[model samples]
Target: MPVPTRKRSPFLTLLPWPERKALAEALRTETVGGLVLLAAAVIALVWANSPWSHSYETVRETHFGISALGLNLSVGHWTSDGLLTLFFLVAGVELKRELVVGELRTPAAAALPVVAAVCGMIVPAVLYVVVAGGGGGSLEGWAVPMATDIAFALAVLAVISTSLPSALRAFLLTLAVVDDLGAIFVIAVFFTSDLNILALLGALAGLVVFYILQRKRVRGWWWYVPLGVVTWGLMYNGGIHATVAGVAMGLILRATADDGTDGRKAEAMSPGDRTAHLLRPYSAAIAVPLFALFAAGVSVSLASLGDVFTRPEPLGVVLGLVVGKTLGIFCGTYLAARFTRARLNPDLSWADVFALSVLAGIGFTVALLIGELAFPDGAVAGHVKAAVLCGSLISAALAALLLKRRDRVYRRLCEVENRDDDADGIPDVYQQGQGEAK
Candidate 1:
């Protein structure tokens, strides 16, 4: 008797090799990046609490930049304001792809996550206000918990829930994109100081030119890099966060080439996709971890950790991130399914959704950004940063516990779905599902 041979799944075989490689490489990069980011955060925490804590503070406060250009900022500010743009640029590219060709392309498919993201933002802000008593100087920090660090959340998922459905990752990515957008809007509207209209107009003009070049299929880092720097510089000078320029550049680039193409596959390989593919690794592995190293280094002695719970602002941040995020995301998703045509994937249960929601509460990167902006004074900022770390840690622990408990079910489902019982290689389960969908 001849032995049965194993082959690729029909879905995997259908995709181009380069696309498949890129997808696989991206997942690996993000998983590795998440690990690196965690290590960086841990180092920062240790350094901040060590006997040499003053050295950490001194390094963070050291200034470096062109003072003539009004660009001199501390080490921490540079991390938060400058390096973080790369992260947002990748996010912008991802958001554009989702809007154009990915899960968010349709109204119904997009509605659930978008609504969930909105509620996720709103509820956290409301909770912050209520907990912190948003009257005197406390309301500024309300936006701190409204962010979900995509790298960190995805990292956690990659570590523990490898067998989970792809839709959950899609949902999380979409949620993070919308969450970042909300944070950007909040920063631009509320946190900006000394707006310079002329510089803003210049940034707009630069974006227009960049868009035109992208339409002409202008390739090479030489052309885009200089233009990107100019745009970022202008936006920074214009009193808008420099990171917004990153998003603008990402969004302006066409997701699909305008070659009068009819096929979906051809259009899928756009400048945006290529840019994201090339830049995502650096954004995840280097830029983000460095930023975390600089931004997350706050002295969290036992006393400060205790104070974080008692202080109104830090208390609000904790509640907003841990409780408000889970409540808001779960309720929003449930409401979307209940009222709209949108429904959860059959492979996912409400338990899975709740776990994902808790995972979304890991608001590390942008949460730190907002906390810095909200309380620029170093005295209080440290406590708030401690709160963010605490809250995010709690959320991650809960999410991991819940997801691990359900790993058996997901593993069984994965094996069943990928089971190729027939002598021929393709999984009958997937073929049948696709047939039913069609």
Candidate 2:
């Protein structure tokens, strides 16, 4: 008997091969992710500030979910809380990978990025407080500018510098990873409300169970999915943000199986790597963009822009991202190198570090999320969002100019290194220098 083939979805079948290929590639590329995020944010801003602005607000505030279980929330809240959990889960997996085998495995390798990330967070916070101190806005927003959006920064660098070395990219990725982990901690600690001790303990109990299951080599997704949902629900009930549950789930998954035997015929992938691979595209392309669309739709006008200048909060955020971020990262990296006697890779330079430091100022995702958490349903929240957009834009433009200059230098270096006489592949200077050494 012949078996029937499963019917393909119209969505997949309708798309052209080239378009699907481009989308698959784009989902894997940080540059494309950043562009999509930017496009979403821009579209949101235009819609919010346009003639149909009230309609945008109405849609954002529309209620959804089952009210009986206290699951109902505004559209924006669902995006921020429900959708962003996926992103955080992926982040958790990445954090585990870095800790287990990546650049963060060794203290010596992790020192510079850790120090830079710490300083990068601290200086901006201090600057925010200083600029907005004693002002009309609350100081609760100190953490708003403390994040570095890795996707945006990498996108900028990728566009402007094709010859940029991988070492530099690795450094930036490490710093952002640390920065994001810190931001998660801050959210769980500082932003939670009406904490329930019993529910929190339940959440902990669930986490312990999840960890034990992984230790026992529980490999099926069917077993873990329900556990994750129950944990998330318990976390939300405990007055903790549901997103923290995702992070918890991510950290507990085994980077390597506990058993010594490499049963590859049965065990195909590590838990963390498999989970990340399954979820990263969804988190990047769907969850993040939806979050951006909802979080970024702030109505802006000339009057509001004028008012932002007057308010300490907006100015503080702008300066925090544009100036504080650059200063903090550069000084921190410089100090780490000075004290530890750690040498930078030969392909990198102080100028390159400085340029990348400025790019780190693009604090979009976490910054906007924190702004909403800090001043929910307040006028200042809108201003904070606007300031985040403006600040990130300025940083991207400045980094582009700086990186362009550096790109020229790298191109010349590449050309010189590739220069060959007598139609030989090797450069003449290299051959001549080798002859002398011999």
Candidate 3:
């Protein structure tokens, strides 16, 4: 008898329906947001190169801040340093959920993505060092390619991978969650300057209070909103990226269930989940696009284009994203499945993994942020930003080509699987003794 394909998942843990739906919706929202971000980038690019370029720069450099809080960031800084925190908060929540209740909860489920993500980060930094640092160039940009923009990657995948194995998307999600964590660690550890111990202590104290509130099953936005703001500000004053505070607050939130008056139950949605759902749309539509507008507006010229490839640092960024990410991710997953006890999901092919690995190279949002941090001077930073955009576009195009080909192959496989049926002439998915269809 032919085996049924509908219900079996040898390697991936299928999430409950509600969680699955939420994850799907979140991906969809981010996918659309990616398109909007692209539009914003285009607008910025055009505006920067236009005769009105001075106006764009004037607007970006305009300063506005709360005097008492000691925050007087420029408009561009407001977008990157302030508005981008929403994105970090949502990412942190997703990471927490995955660790607590999703595939990453178990070592078996985590092994492949964890290995892939770690190598994905390490190889890029190594490649950047080889290209840039080896020449005695500044090594500050090494971490720029260590990120994979989830929205951009997912948008590309969704466009050309309709028939790919479901496990592939799951793998990308977990891999990206781990990638985001790596990026966050790099920003906090390396980008920070002029550490303020008092402000740092204040942020820690705020987080402690937040944890206590959650433990007490506290409710209402009033308790959390102001506290989160204060903590974020304190983190900024502490000379750390303020976005770290968002991640801290998100991690402190309970993931298994909401802090409701009701007893702890498996069925209840978590506060973190609830918050993520509410904030994700705002983050995707407004926060990210805004950041791209400010961060991606590089003054385009033939000279800058040439510099991206000719200069050590900029060329290193391009190679890190285009070459290092693909090699790192594909080789990492391959090594894990071969040498370790881990097994690849039977439903997905090595071809699919390769295509997905290519897709993981779209490092836009955090890449820009890191490039900004690495090179504060406008001229060099513009060249680096151009490199990131060019590299990401090339990766997206290559991944789309490969995934579309794999999608055709998987479509044929799925058609074959759908034909298998029981003696009763029913589809195997609905046959007797089969588990209820998910």
Candidate 4:
């Protein structure tokens, strides 16, 4: 028997010169972002181990200040706490969009992922708590595994771009967004410190003002930027993690912004289109990649790995992120789909789900942030960083392999189905009948 080949679409081949060129440019932009991230990671690893390691640490940790503005923070802090706020703001806006009109718009569409996210969150934390024990303040890091860094996760998908189906990619993206929402809630509620009532009041007041402005249909971001900065400062002083301010501000701003419509009235948008149109490009093309470059640049050393495994907190974290994340996400998503009405991605098999779950174990960005919050100083923090890097790398590799295998099987099945349809001669039969009548 001859091997059946998939037919190419003539319409795609006959695209106008301009349209094809535009599409090529868009693809280049997307490709560049992934390349940038990979390049950054490679440089960071080399720089961290080089003799100029001190210079790298110094540059990251050196304090910079806007004295007139009363802002003082290390380069790392500025990136993580300040610049990364924009990253979270974009994330928050996306979350709100999804809840209002995207995949999470309806109970039926949203239930599977929400249930999966809840299970994904609860199971990992439970595993971390169990493994670390209930005492010694070790349980503080419970929320670490709850997050899914969408950029890094997507980057992993890009590595095996040819193998994974679009449906699987969409499923993972939605799941990661849901996962991020859970992580944000966990951070806001659990990781907070002693409240400074005055600062808390100031932050709340700032939020209210932003909300009012949004209701007034403010179109420009300039109006909100200063308020957002103040809100972050107040939240920082208020004993809440400052990043929450970004999320809060983004939600209010997006809720209020006028989505361009029929040039008549502004209230006609379905919320998702408005928010996504406003934030998608900025988020994907700029904010996210910048955050990855800054956040993923941890110092690496051969000695650090040996010391990292010796500490309990780091060991627990590494184990939780790699082992706990894979098991929890796969088991949770699988059980929910099996037992409930929520449908799994039509193109994905059990093997595909398991593989994507392993990729979920790549908890680099969020894990690093959580480590910073969980252990401010001491040997624990060092170990946690090492474990996060090591475990994330391992999970990413394993997941990629699994996904490649699953993709081969999935493609074969699709080919078989297509062949069966062609054999049935439905198209040829219809064409022949039409010709005879003519």
Candidate 5:
């Protein structure tokens, strides 16, 4: 007799137990953070439009930081430039894990999301340029709509999806992580200020020292924490976004537990894992939400709302996020699977993939940040922020509708699957009827 063989699912195979556990924990934290971020954005919008709008402006303008380090910035700038680093750091950790040990460890597994994410970004920028680049309209905001807010997307998924396969969640998270990396690269490459060579070199030196400490297995918060601040300040002064510093540090840290280099016992967790675990709650609950509070305080009115559609730049943002993101991701995934060795998961249909692509359109946090970077002037920036809010809200609503419908289908399938006429315990309806017939 021949031995029985097991077949595997295509594209996204079930992750190992350890990886699944890690992914689950990260998703939960991000979901809660998404809710908090939403709340903060809501408060900001309300306060900015309310009778106390002047007070809101005052608070956002208040400045305080280490003056000697060239760190003093307005509250709004601090939130965008400083607190947002925590969010990016968490993003960096997620990328490190996925690349090193998670779904992205293999090229086949990574290709699906990677292809989709790349298309997702390119289409948005192309669409933005098409819509906004007419009559020498500035192409500065081309990259604004290229990100997916992981927290908000995951949070919306949690609410709408039940009984869906875990693979779907993993796929979405991986795609968003790739999307985030692209956004970070755009920020680093395109949105820089005048270069300060000395400050940039100093920042690079600090990163080298930080990397060395990690390699030497130096484990002390006191030693690295201050160094991190110095590095961030230098990077900020060095004409690059300070958030780059956080990601740089995160990537430099080891993602896997290692044997003791010196005469010491091996630790159970790697420094990267330990830091991500310790900081994720703060990043999700406090850092991101606080940033959203300051960043999302765009005043809303009939004129501002109308400008989102009438103005070329803001209009481009809206169309890029909603239309471009949906088509790019769906089409790109199909192309990859068709041309390459990748295959669609047996558990998912094209409709489900379409819905997932639509969900990727919620580019809340990073879109607004890029909007500020692109349109620094007050009036245009305000309009662009409004456009981001509008685009994300529209995407969320569409995704929610599609996801809820799919969740119901999956729920029905689950019921049929679990209904067993032959089980020993509490017989199914079929068995009860058959017994009566007998």
Candidate 6:
């Protein structure tokens, strides 16, 4: 006999508008993503140390490949080189969206973070270059600290509830987006070693074709997936980093079919609203989470710790991420605000700015990715991983402490001001009678 299936209740969805809005907003915020990443990190640590550690290592490193049509890569390489291209594509889409309509929409809105991101990227790279300048292998990992992992940084923010104002959170997010943009550019230009000119041309042609498809109102992403794979193959062979194919493909596909000046897609009824509605869920849910799971796992051990600190390349990375990131971000933002007419977030005091700067130093995910790219060999890679983890922890701690202190100060000031206002409101005769009674 067939069993009765439970009917899904539509009443479960009949909540008030405000409740629905709150739920949506909570989901959109970085909180859920942060929790997911934190869980992944914990799991990675556990897996690395457990008796099944060999299984974890074997699964991650075991070579799986598809060579049927001249394309070749191991399972780990495919995950990093192929799948991660999609991740970067999603990142590129978000960057474009932000610049076009979101937080980085205007020069004033974009300036402070752009400047800060530049400094943040430049200073750490310079620090790494300085520390590693004399060595033969050291120079290869210049881009190691030139990233801000949005997931890890946001996770740190999630843990420290009162350290940042809402506006400051917006500011950090913008800066991180800009930071990612810079890192993409760096990877495309610098890290690539070999050049397959014909493949490069093919990649460019694929982008053009994708652009035309977008212009013709192709909405289904599946249509472009094969072309994107071709683009990735071309880039992989073209001496450009394979991940760059993701960015290039994203730029073409995400171009809104809308007319820019009127802020509406001429073809769509609801203006910019419809386009955003379509892309938002895809970007936030599927793309970002898949990227996190694919990119986050790294083996941890007591022996690995010793190798991490003693190696110059990884040591430089740690210092650059911890020291360079905080100082560079703080100085860049502060200086930009001081010199320019860009208005500061009303809720953020100087103390809050400094705290946010420290939070910006949490560079775990992106830094680790860079380390992987910069050092493919196992020897120094372990050190780089250690540095990223240590630096991020230090930054998170410092930011949390500073933010908590600033919150306390703010509360005290508010209390004092409230007392003054109360005293002023009391009548002089009433006050004198009260004093006499006392």
Model 2: per-residue Cα lDDT over 191-253, one tens digit each: 999999998898899999999998777678988988887788788889888899888888888
Highest-scoring model, TM-score: 2
Residue-level lDDT for 207 in candidate 3: 98
Question: What lDDT would candidate 4 get against the real structure?
Answer: 0.71
Instruction: Assess the local accuracy of residue 180 in candidate 1 as a C-alpha lDDT between 0 and 100.
Output: 86
lDDT of each: 0.85, 0.86, 0.89, 0.71, 0.89, 0.72
CA deviation > 4 Å runs, candidate 4: 1-34, 134-137, 255-299, 417-438
lDDT of model 4 at residue 90?
66
Q: Tens-digit lDDT track for model 1 on 237-259?
A: 99898899998888877786555
Candidate 1, position 35, lDDT? 83
Error of 5 at 87 (Å): 0.6
- Taking all chains together, each candidate's TM-score versus the true structure is 0.86, 0.91, 0.89, 0.81, 0.89, 0.79
lDDT for position 82 in model 4: 71
Candidate 2 Cα errors over 4 Å, as ranges: 1-22, 67-69, 134-136, 256-268, 420-438
What lDDT does model 1 reach? Answer: 0.85
The sequence of per-residue lDDT tens digits that candidate 3 reaches over residues 12-131 is 878889996776576346567788888999999999999999999999999999887889999999999888999999899999999999879999989999999999999999999999
User: 349, model 3: CA deviation in Å?
Assistant: 1.4
